[model samples]
Target: MSIAIIGPAEIEAMIDREVADYPTDTRAGAQTLEAFQNARRKPRLVSVNFSGGITQKCYSVTRPNGDYRVIYLPLAGYFSLCVESDFGPLDIGVHGPAIACFGSV
Candidate 1:
């Protein structure tokens, strides 16, 4: 099956909820929200789909409405999103801390 399409409103709502409720109110929350929103505003070079099991970070990963993935869990202060392709993972949030360590790299 291919990925479904969701409207901008729904995506916005998801981001808002994530931003408002994310624990610790860390920088990740703000940046994550911005990244998602920024993604929507542009014409993506790739299209987000779930059929291939995260084909690419084309766009959002939703349950049924779209390819958007929502990680709403208790004590889950962070949202880890990884975009995978036929080759390998495209984007990994796990290395966030490690990347921050490189001062102005």
Candidate 2:
């Protein structure tokens, strides 16, 4: 939805919630949250809606309002940003001591 439609207050609330949900103890967390807030302030791209449920390989998943795949990066000390992907949770990447799986969520 457009920021005009959601209004400034709602958008700020969303950004605040995202920032609050993440621990800012790590550099990655701070940078991620900063970039996220900056992007929201100057949104440059339309959001894409990925289709289909996850078919295989998911570190973690959630469905608060929409499906999200999350994976904690132990070294990085925080979970990767929850994202909707063309490959679902498989798109988190193939490197690192990642949590692996072979089922739909």
Candidate 3:
């Protein structure tokens, strides 16, 4: 699979769409916004899981809404941003790797 890099502008646009999808006042909507903001600050790789010999790095941030976890596949240039809210888990998965390469930044 080819990895496509995602730019900051594209990420912001995605967050804007997500925020628009729900009313800001609502808990779900608020959490979505919070998640986006937290992600905007600084995304860090918190852990690397090697379960069953399959490696997976979890990038995360802590927010008022909840803990946001980013599942980014450097090789595939794909990523999924998510948060656990009162309603459930809010997630955005995208496939795009511009500067596609493996390992942490």
Candidate 4:
């Protein structure tokens, strides 16, 4: 299979779709928010500098196969993923709730 590369606009759209999945009025939504808050309490996560003075949460996960980074912005209600690339850290459009982003690790 061939690889496909997407641009910033497409990434933004994916993030929008992921964030739209949960409604704040529902129990699932509440759980999502709680999960993010719980992640914030942990020290395993790292801090990254974001635009507009926002400190985004990040964690570098390593496995025998490869490595990837997870990012969370609680105020924005979303999470993202990044992988080390030949050029630099390449962000893959992985926007979603806390459990969906951080539960596996």
Q: What is the C-alpha lDDT of each candidate?
A: 0.36, 0.36, 0.42, 0.46
TM-score each candidate: 0.31, 0.30, 0.36, 0.33
Candidate order by TM-score, highest to lowest?
3, 4, 1, 2
Off by over 4 Å in 4: 31-99, 102-105
Candidate 3 to truth, TM: 0.36
The candidate that achieves the highest TM-score relative to the unseen native structure: 3
Candidate 2 clashing pairs, residues 3+ apart or interchain: none
Question: 61-92 in candidate 4: lDDT tens per residue?
Answer: 31211445455443444555545454433445
Candidate topping lDDT: 4
Per-residue lDDT tens digits for candidate 1, residues 13-96, read 555664466444678656654454443332222433333455443332322113223221112222233344554334443322
| Tens-digit lDDT string for candidate 2 (1-105) | 322234334434543565577666989657755544443332111222223542322223222124433343322323333455543433443332211111122
- Candidate 3 local Cα displacement, residue 84, angstroms: 14
Local lDDT at 9 for model 1:
56
Q: lDDT tens digits, residues 4-72, model 3?
A: 665545544544564466457878557655545554433345433332534454433223234444444
Residue pairs in collision within model 1: 60-67, 60-68, 61-67, 61-68, 61-69, 62-67, 62-68
Superposition error at 37 for model 1 (Å): 9.6
